[model samples]
Target: MTLSRALAIAGFVVAGLALLAVEWAARRPDSRVPTLGAVVALVMRYDVGGLPVGRLAILLFWFWLGWHFLAR
Candidate 1:
């Protein structure tokens, strides 16, 4: 296999492992690892000049992701 293809596969493997770790952590009742929802809530709590800058940042990120990956 080409180096690029091998690197891509390795990246995917790492991502999958990370996802599994998060899932495992989230399932434990007393685990210190925060769930994804908690993380989002924490981000959403930030504000600047009474504007929800954190939410705006997350919305912009989603828009950019969709524009690049889901746009036809």
Candidate 2:
């Protein structure tokens, strides 16, 4: 794959890991870190794809939906 595609995949993997870490942190009471981490993950997922167009559009749509709910 091209460098761009590889980076995109890497971004997705990293975001997934971050989201998991946030969930783990969320289990701890009084921790706001989880919420912050989850938001970062959502933003990265939105940004690494760069824009909402073509295949990215479909992916961004779902990402935005998740962000809308989870980010709140």
Candidate 3:
């Protein structure tokens, strides 16, 4: 296989492993790893002058990511 294709496959494998790890951690009650909802709540708590800057920033990031990588 070409080097780029191999690298892409490796990247996907790593991402999948990371997702699995997160799922496992979130499922374990005694695990120190914070759940996705907790992380989002923490981020959403940040604000600037009564505006939810963190939430807005996350929304913008998701929009940009979807537009660039997921859109056909």
Candidate 4:
């Protein structure tokens, strides 16, 4: 596969792990993993251009942690 595709996949994986980390961390004081996941999703959806930001957004939702369900 192309490097860009590989990186995009990797980025998605990292972002996913970051989300999970944040969620699990939320069970304690250093609840940075969940927040970090939201941040990653936000950053990925920030219109980076030709970098699979869309893919990141999609993957970020896979966890369904509902990190943004109450904001409306």
Kindly list the per-residue Cα lDDT of model 3 for residues 1-72, writing each as its tens digit.
999989988998999899888978888988888887888889989998999998998899899979977999
Backbone clash total for model 2 is 0
Local lDDT at 32 for model 2? 67
Task: Quantify all predictions' global Cα lDDT against the true fold.
Answer: 0.90, 0.73, 0.89, 0.70
* Candidate 2 local lDDT, residue 62: 86
Task: Sort every candidate by TM-score, greatest first.
Answer: 1, 3, 2, 4
Better of 3 and 4 by lDDT: 3
lDDT of 2 by residue, 1-46 (tens): 9999899889989999987887888878887665755665565565
* Cα error, candidate 1, residue 27 (Å): 2.1
Best by TM-score: 1
Worst 10 residues of 1 by lDDT: 30-39
Ranking by lDDT: 1, 3, 2, 4
Overall local distance difference test of candidate 4: 0.70
- 2 or 3: which has the higher lDDT? 3
State every prediction's TM-score relative to the real structure.
0.72, 0.43, 0.71, 0.40
Q: For model 2, where is the 10-residue window of minimal lDDT?
A: 46-55
Clashes of each: 0, 0, 0, 3
Worst 10 residues of 4 by lDDT: 63-72
Of models 1 and 4, which has the larger lDDT? 1
* Runs in model 2 lying further than 4 Å from the true structure: 29-72
